[model samples]
Target chain A: MDERFALVGLCPAAEQAAPKGRRPGKRPALAAAFLALMVLGCLLFPLLLTKDPASMDLSNYAREPDGTFWFGTDTMGRDIFAMIWSGGRVSLSIGFLATALSTVIAVAVGAVSGLAPRWLDALIMRLTDILLSIPSLLVIILLQAALGRANIASLSLVIGATGWMSVARVVRTEVRQLRTSEYVAAARCMGGGTFHILRRHLAPNFLASIMFMVVMNVRGAIVAESTLSFMGAGLPLDTVSWGSMLSLAENALTAGAWWIVLIPGLFLVATLLAVTELGEWLRRSANRGQSNL
Target chain B: MCETLLDVRGLCHSFPLGAGRYLRAVDGVSFRIRKGEIFGLVGESGSGKSTVARCVMNILRPQAGSILYRGVDVCDPAQFRANRRMLQTERQIIFQDSSSSLDQRMKVADIIAEPLAVNHIVPPRGSLRAEAAFQLRYVGMDPAYLDRYPPELSGGQRQRVAIARALTMEPSLLVADEPIAALDVSIQAQIINLFRHLQAEHGFTFLFIAHDLAVVRYLCDRVGVLYRGKLVEMAPTKELFDRPLHPYTKALLSAIPIPDPRRERARTRFHFDEAAFDRTGGFVQVSPEHFVLGGKEAEP
Candidate 1:
């Protein structure tokens, strides 16, 4: 974006338009707005696009981008533009599903460890440490291979299962701090149930920590899927994910069809940037009155 | 009204300072609150006043003690579990720092009504919101503050909301641990008056803890004076104030500042002699409704 701004900066009209000192809320809102639009476009991919992304048109195969075909066509004659959007739907779904799964696990572990007695807290933390010692990507691949399925759903489950350890550590630390808070003591004194305290007292207080974690997990899941599919372990080519879309990059490289690789890679990188910017923004706000995770 | 509502016997608590050592916060401190009576525990800072209050409210499990609330031993795990809801519901605590004591994210209405909703008790006033509003009004606060959060309110307002929260359960026992210690001088009197008015009208039993002698004398029915976590004196408030028996109690009373500069400068202030202090001293009754800890041997 800054590069584009610099290019536009050569023109005086554009230089006059770009204002500085936007309030803290504005930048994140712009990023969130872009993400929301991208998500909407991906979700409504079928409704917006007329071409069948999977169907081959041998005569128009491997053509350069033109007025009719925005991202041109891949070697198999599949529309690269349609593939990017449709694959985005899969990528974002994995991000959302994996994020939800990991968040639930993270909160549960964090709450338990944070509120538990010293020895028990040590035990839980040590277990997390052991899990953290092992590389998560390797574990996800091994789990996926052992399950004998590389489908999108199972892949998300595997990624999610492996992703919660770090966030859980953050949550446990946050919860430990929050447990000493007077309101929690007051809530306990009122005879609120454990679940009630967790939901009512603990959740809202540690929400910022969890929000940043959730956003980062979405970004992580997307990258993990892309990496795994770029390798041979992710969803099959038929599933049409961004990772699977990228998996065909080697073939496109051999065929010298640059659009097929560059278009999807550019979209994925841009999406990752927006997601990362939003996560960092949330992290900065969370840090205003809290310890950084 | 004369019946004991809460009885604490041999309360002793210590926090481990690591290195196999303990810092005893409360040691063998015991007092009773009769039904519909105000019982004040007065002590200097680090004198275990808050510890005693926390032990009574069952927020901290004492190392050695039996707290009998309504004649049930709350320290025994099985017995406490059996009557846990009753004990917890009937006993509420108002912590000193109400801004932190009250959930900051929760609105005033939710803060007050949380105990009702959590315990699944049907509100007597038709709805929890109504109960909350009534509690707010009872605490001399308008229902208009219901939508506001704790951070938006002043320290005194937050303390009032804390009181209102405790009152929603219509708790028979209210443990106020230095509730006004964090308030300004003017706000302290307002809160003290509010507490006095609330108790007179509702007859709620109170276990008030404070370092402020004047407020305790004005508000409490009976007073217990603690010196270094030991109960040095116990008597009715008027009796204790007028005729303090122990040397430490005398020293404590003397510490209260006199208003007039003439009397204040000329007043004889008693100082406690640590050489004369004895931890082995047992309670000895010198007069009706009055007891002093020293001048007697340890009793079996």
Candidate 2:
């Protein structure tokens, strides 16, 4: 791959010690503040929810919080705040784990397929396109229906399998651009194998895009999980979630007991908003990396 | 007698012309590059000059012919893969656009050290930083630049980093494909002089490929002219310039724009139409080490 036609080997010694100019931005500060708050709030859930979320009280059913229960009671007399906290772990885990797993798979597959020879690239891209054409929700639903009764793992698998296409596409484009660069050619000249180059150079260089995609994918996974749970296809009935809470309270909305749905809905919206904001921040940073010239 | 380090024989490459037709980019091009000498490849755009360089680098596989290094054919995939480490250690390349060529994610030190690490020429667990710094110094860069990214550096600096990376493995032959084309004219001279000085100091063989004849004239010991994937002429620089056997070479020489406005006004530019020679075959020798493809030898 000795594609390098000319090499420049002289650096300006006089300017070597000069510091690079910095661009001003407050985005990092905002992101740090939000993330810190989220960590604190999430970490306190177990300590806050001492009682089992499914524990029922026939006597205090639908009682508003006055002294004991802080967020009032559901139709089964379970605490609303306690259920939200207890259920947060599963939803957050599904979102983070599914996104991470899918991203890793996409990066590996895309980098290899993208950097492969023309025929291989064509084959991989065609397969990717076919996969992408299948509607995500429908695919998840089909897998769940075929498998019969989806658990958290199966739900994550369904979401992750369908969610990889966009990441793969993004990585493929990056690898294509990078393959034309001289360093990759230089690496080839140095007897670095295909996998070696991908692992050492291509993967590292494509990190900004990969990170941005992962952040966005996490948000997407969260929304997908919520949707599946809302439709009664995600998690079991024993598991409590923001979506399940809303599903249960949907019938009682006209009975003047609006607190059951309102609280969980607000939490879901807030969580989604926070994740979307984080994704935007990551995307901005990735864009800055791309515009380094 | 010079030892031939690179021997390119009967090399031909082509792509689909369209509608089941194919166009040959390099046809039966045969030449030998000697160790410790800079061989210049000069041609206009679409002349397949760069294609020849690409073929030698194994970036683009040729349709026919053999590229031999040290008396072994490298066109075979098995042989090429088996001897890849040796090939990389023996030969390296620099590109036209330094910015596009350099990996933006890498720090100056890591970029320079990549060749050494990839080749395993140096111990992996040992102090690569110290060795990288020494190599950087050899290329006129200071130790302070080890941490800076490519985007933080200027064009010339980036190119320097690129060169440093190529040289880290101590390759005996370097292929430079218009190294200074992307830089400012002022910076071009500096980089060109740097290359000349480095070649002289290290005694490294070079295949200097470029479109600028003037730069080729100043830097190369011997020059070869290519037209549409065929070598039209090859001669010592002085001999070729003084008495160009090929009409194409003559036309090319006449086209070098004089840097000075007054000199430009005083000079006559040669007119050339590429289509006029389309019907002709490949190059034929008219003098010792000099040739032209077309039949025309008479002055216009």
Candidate 3:
């Protein structure tokens, strides 16, 4: 009987062939290029522009765009072009730093909660649920108000603290699913410790999800930082940011100096768009990589 | 009599189904695997054969039972923790789904080397590579395939890689849960042969779980028939095949289609009636080395 069953067929003919040549699509490429250029411009813009963004020129207050002031003077007579570049640095840094802090915390908390004992997992998950239920903007505002001042560092910290809940949820779900996989069971049978199974098996499998979360969180942090600044709870008055610039342009809009609001708004919208496009591209590519596996 | 390598006594495990309901996965299962022997646990899907394997492997702790390996009671938490390293080194498992059983992100060489590395049995770099290559060759794959990932390999090749990984630990016992169930028919024979060869060479005991009787009969020395999480019958493979004592065993045997067309057409299968029997009773020994459940008899 065994021989008959054995001789019934050779190897299955429809074996999964290796994936063929893969190339990055055009949209992601353009998005990536744009992001790179923006980052480079942010880094080099302040040095290349001769005027300091914060230096008020009361003599030239509310000047229109000319060769001397590419983006015109704001209500305070600061160079809008230099202020825009300087603001870009602050916004980008806050975004990057906040994303980094949140991702680290999320990965650690998520992995532990997912792989922890039943009681601990329940406790952690309940805590996360509570955090998720609260309005994040309100929490950030309360934190900023309590702290009494919103600097670049404090604003980044506030955004990071509020933003990790979603990432934690994503990682927790992924880890929980991975824990039940046969490989994890096999690892356990082979006498693998909890740390070993988590580090070697679960972590690598869920890395793509983690990466996707980090990128998405960066965009979230940028928006959160801008919102805080727009609401007059962001950086100090002397420090210029896209959000602060928009806030300052409110009075100028009544006087019809539209460039003050439009220029900074354009920067914010373009950066956000680029980031969203890049994140979408990353998610698609990660999915493709997973399907290939 | 051969020395007993493993003895499981009255193993019981259950899963909660919410609202205070429970699904009994393994109920009062008892078995022993002698050294240098292959013990087969055969049952239909969802009959809890895999659960038994997991219980024996210590992957899942049985709510009520004692599992003794080499005369050490592994069911005791203290003993299990104290001897964990030794037990882990001695017992390993090969899973049914080879693709999922392997880490997708890892290369083949890393997958095989993981057990050794995690156990801190780090050989020098050259020797480690050599050892991985050796196991690959032993499993009938070329060394060049080590750099590739699990997704790149065929199912048979992936199973072979899994087997190679298991062998890397040099385990005294291997709990194979439907190891060949996912393979092609032709590949199944080859893997079965590989198991046989490896057993002969290493003298390792195997707890082979499968739903296919023909394959179990080909590989195992002793066969235990599990029906709905209970051991209904157990005997030497040949005896069980020749004279199946339990009604479920008879039904299983009849279900194996004969190769001859006339006999295959003429065969009458016995349908099991679950409502007819008292499943709570213990096994009754009908003959030496043969046991049948749900009959009045003297206890061993």
Candidate 4:
């Protein structure tokens, strides 16, 4: 039998047909449920925050925590809670949007590269390697510098452009494997064209790997955007990003106005952790589904 | 066996090895499968048996070959495409390891209906469920199994589903590549018997590829022996088994153990000297419809 055509061997009937007794443990769905709620809460928080993210009270600059402000005030006397919520909207959205864009780019490039003839596959993978070898953050920085200051769209394009190489490489390997699978040949036997094979046979099987990459990249994108903001390359100073808030609080840190940096930093950490955890959970769930088959 | 439906002539395929080396995987193999005949292709691993099957199905192009279906050259891409619908409807492949052959995400019904969907034989919005149900029952699968995913099926059941899926196209040729090798021994016999029964009922031609001679003997009416990349010997099943002319064929046959260990010990032990196996010679017809190549008999 062709190794490429070897069955995934996890079919549902495989379990029933096996002369065995014990079944494997399935993934607990609660973790995903909790993570989903957290993501929804984060997504909706900015929309719920009534005050303008940049709206500042000059009289209350650097004020300590009080009943009026749940998270006290930043250097500009902006409500830390409101700013964090609003900044989170940009950070999280950019992360996900950029990750999605990159995933599409990578999957397309990789699948094409992998399924193409040997020379073409090598060409695409070599291009991927060259892109992957360069420091992604440096590429983003260079692009941002050359292309001008960071708006959400520009930042996303830069991050997305640099991020696709890894995904392309991963998807390329998967495509290479899938291109030779029996179902793929079956589709061909049914007179399916290359596009049909790509759309039906190759794409769906590798979607899980792509999704996992997207989730991980979201964390990376968020952190990248925050880093850009800290360097004064991201959203405008008045935009009240968590990064800009951190930038503003840097001077106040020595004066013991700790809430200026601490709260926003915690928020960034939580968001990254939440997304990473969510990605890991999704990967495990997919694996469990395979084993159950 | 019935009237010949597919005629393959002088098929040769060679792939470029690194550093300008040429590795031949299929060398001048030729055979004719009659309509409703079970033609077995037997070889060890790397013997090019699967490659031959691929060439017959046009999954892999042969550098020098002509596959004639009803006297039409199927090797030509344009002609093959022109007859694509007929090809799909008249020929199908049942792959080894049914789970891998089936799309994991698809339900049993959807998997069976894929050919129909792709060919547009069934309307996009038509009663695909009923069609899927009909195909399922054709392979002895229960209609209730339709809603279930591939993963829920056992190996024997999955192979049966694979057979059903292939037969759904109403193909005259079913290229089953090591269909039962991935299955357990106990289940292998059942799958083999099911194939036999289906062939008996449907009168479908089968290009059954396998490394197992015993199984091939049970399933095929005519047998072709593949060695490395060459078709070393081909004859009617009984003749090929009784009088294997090629050294490779003789070696392969000797390796098949007789059912009783005591009788097996008494059988001649053929030496498969790899050094001698690598030597090459062109095929020569020794008897009517029987050929042998790369041995002292052919050389002299």
Candidate 5:
């Protein structure tokens, strides 16, 4: 050993208490719990509700909360309490379905581009770049108009189609890098087939890299669906949803019924915040211990 | 069995630098490895040692030359495809950096058993985990680490796992490209000793690439000195160390430090002059097992 290093005698383990790859902070925990409650309530609580979300009561139209109404009524006199959870089913489902569609499209595009020859890869990347360069809202509106009248299914498809470009680029870069990593080359030398390498080595890493994106895509899809509905691009006014409720409540806003829009808006922002926090936590957890390697 | 397990004739390769330029990494280099013998290739950084190793392992295709392993010409795409499984099974390579060479996502057991799983071969030890454990123990590793990922282990442990993974296939030819270069000095000795034991007991053929002449002398049956992508000298280990002929080889050997203070002070370094190097000279056979470049034909 060098005499200089020997004299230092190695610093004691004073910094050991700092720990490595810490757990998610308090905010993520609270967000996770909130999301869990929302999902459970939205998925199951409507089954027990006696009041119909679509039923109207003109006598209590836009009335403040009373003994009979928990969240009061909107301009249509529809019960807001019943509407929130019931509409939650539509909004949440569309969000998740759109997220799934976008994820599938992104994975396929990324993997194909990552594995393709130089020319084809360049072509695919150029297409993604062009799509990313455009404003996603304009594309979504244009797609919704082109796809005919929008419902939950078409709304999700449009939102998913427009949102996949960024995630695909991210996935493509990661796939290209991991595919050429030395270990993958070693596996190839051992005659490990494409499927074996993908399933055993590549898939795990891809999952870690995309977990955050996948969660964020859900939030993006929900927001996109809301924006479309609010702009009268899709979802007929009859079907109940947070966005359609906001649209119907527009007249109520002019009538000085603040609770009509504020309640659903609060729910939307809360869900977005919760989802973002949980996504960040998932991303950190997936990437933990990586630098140590 | 045939004596010559591997033979390379006039191997050459170059990489394009774009704009119609080329970097000649390896030029007409050739050597043969007999079955069960350790062949050491010593060279400085950027001398194309890794490229040569990659060519031998079929990881890189040489532009010109033929590589015959077990009488199969692996350079031909058709021939290689036809015997891909057999060729892949019988030869394996260990890279220098274990961190990059071993899949961090895989458990040690999976990494060790991957070749068998890929080849559809039933484990000789009854089960995959059992086979993995046996190989792990064989390479001087604890079986308890079978469930651990590569990131969880120290550098030496990871290299040991890499060795175990390579050995699991029971390959006939193992190419190690400076495997000990990234290890600590204490770990280097342990790894070298382990390699020596593996060769002496199992009669494993090895292609060991290194610039450390001392380790090459201690482990290699024969030595080949590379200078700027060309083999300058090749001979039996003892013969090469005692009498290095080429200027580059002399300079390379002179750099080894003697342990004794008096001898270390008395030693004079041989300076290699690049300008004096004869690029057109062919290899001349000075003895049955010795060859040197830029030399007159022997009086024989």
Candidate 6:
């Protein structure tokens, strides 16, 4: 009788479980392939393509697309093809680094704030509210100006520092919810200290949320870098980045050399789309994995 | 009488509801559990039974109280910290919700071995898996469940795993806060029987908190009735059921339906007068063993 009841209860769950085990969908695979190709191109293009991005050839200046140059030439006669790839490496690196730094700070602050006492939680949350209220773009521009330069390192730092409030808020909420979970309380009753409970129970349970924040932060960082560069507060003029290219292309666009603006703009949009798609796929897979477990 | 294993005196706890207002969850509650005895705390939902258990486990810092575990005042911050590790090893808790109590990500073996690993209780080169398997068997579960996650198990099986995990600590004082409340009625009996068997075999003290008066009568040696964050009555299991002194106790006891329809229909349900009972007076002893709150004053 008990076995029959158990089977009856498990039938619906088993049926629900079937879909999770099915083969991966085509869209996620395409997204993953696209992201992988983009990442690989960004990493290798600057090294393999020997065309100098800074060298000037007056005869080729503002030339249209031809057999010699795949993306034509900019106003300075620099190969737009070489410039795009080289700038991609810097832009991608900034996105990756800034997201990593922000995620680390956010996780630490969120975990502490959520798991700490009422006073500490209130203090951290109030600080987060203050930081969140300020316009992040303004903060980043001011920080860039104060730092005296907008190199990759300082640009990444500025974006990372200003972009952590939302991530912190997300992590704090997740950790607070997990803190009240019976498993966490049980861990405490089992002689586990605060750090042990946080590391073992709370951290693993909330990893999907952290991964989500990481993806969002990366996209935000990329966009913020571009916005700053457009405003002349991101990477210096000599530095190669998608944002820097976009900044330089404004004049080229006015002169009717559309390829210079259009090529980099397409690359920027494609990269962001690929990242967003891949992040969505990853989060869905993570959810499926948890459900299966 | 057996030596007192846990003595809680005037324990009070409250939660802030914002705007300088406080909701008192436990109001000056006091009780004691004898060594190797199952002392059940019975109350309706929101009656603060769990709060009292949490206070006894030192999970919640009570506003004002003294909890003496084996004669050591666990409520004192300095003393608790000084012996925190030892105290933790000696006392463990089992929550009501089996699904929420066990970490879903952890396998049965890891969950069971967690306490042993955390307390550094395992011997050098000792196999945690072996100990976990042993605990599983002790709880009448197969060793095959070692690799299974909590989600894979049924409610009863999950609760059994929770019991196995708590047993791994070999604690002297186990605070089971409605451990069987979430299980199906059919499964509740099995878990309760398992608890009774284990308690007898290990001779460990248990603070069993439950809302079911029948289950408490079946498992606990002594039972305390709680109403509105206060103890209304306390006596040995049989005496408390046979002759409940307090009006709230009478109401609670009468609420338990009899199995036979004829007797159930004829029974008069006791109605407790909440407004009539004054809260200013302390518990008055009506008999040598039983204590009742808000009872008639003793005659000269």
Among all candidates shown, the one with the greatest TM-score: 5
Sort by TM-score, top down from the best: 5, 3, 2, 1, 6, 4
Please give, for residues B71-116, the per-residue lDDT of candidate 6 as tens digits.
8899998999898987888898988988888888788999999998
> Stretches of candidate 5 above 4 Å error?
A1-27, B297-300
Per-residue alpha-carbon lDDT of candidate 3 for residues B43-161, written as tens digits (9 for 90 to 100): 99989998888888887889998899998888888998899999988998999999899988888998888888878896544677788887877777778888888987888889988
Q: What's the true lDDT of residue A227 in model 4? A: 84
Candidate 3 on A184-251: residue-level lDDT in tens? 88788777888998888888878777777789888888888888787787887688888888887677
Model 2 chain B — which ten-residue stretch has the worst lDDT?
B291-300
Clashes of each: 0, 10, 0, 15, 0, 0
Q: Candidate 6's C-alpha lDDT?
A: 0.84
**Per-residue lDDT tens digits of candidate 1, residues A115-198?**
899999999999999999999889998999998968768988999998999889988998899888888888888888778988
Query: Which residue pairs overlap in candidate 5's backbone?
Result: none
Pick by lDDT: 4 or 5, better one? 5
lDDT score at residue A273, model 3, on the 0-100 scale: 85
TM-score of each: 0.90, 0.91, 0.92, 0.87, 0.94, 0.89
Give the residue spans of candidate 1 off by over 4 A: A1-24, A248-258, A280-293, B296-300
Candidate 5 positional error at A264, Å: 0.9
Overall lDDT per candidate, in order of appearance: 0.86, 0.78, 0.86, 0.80, 0.86, 0.84
What clash pairs does model 6 have? none
State the lDDT of candidate 5 residue by residue for B4-84, as single tens digits: 999988888899999999888888888888999999999899888999999888888999999999889999999999999
TM-score of chain B of each: 0.96, 0.91, 0.96, 0.92, 0.97, 0.97
Alpha-carbon runs more than 4 Å astray in model 6: A1-27, A285-293, B17-22, B123-125, B278-288, B294-300
Segments of candidate 4 deviating more than 4 angstroms: A1-50, A291-293, B123-126, B147-152, B242-255, B268-300
Q: Positional deviation of B286 in candidate 2, in angstroms?
A: 5.9
- Give the per-residue Cα lDDT of candidate 4 at A112: 83
lDDT tens per residue, model 2, A166-208: 8898899889988877778767876777877888788887878
For candidate 1 chain B, the 10 contiguous residues with the lowest summed lDDT are B291-300
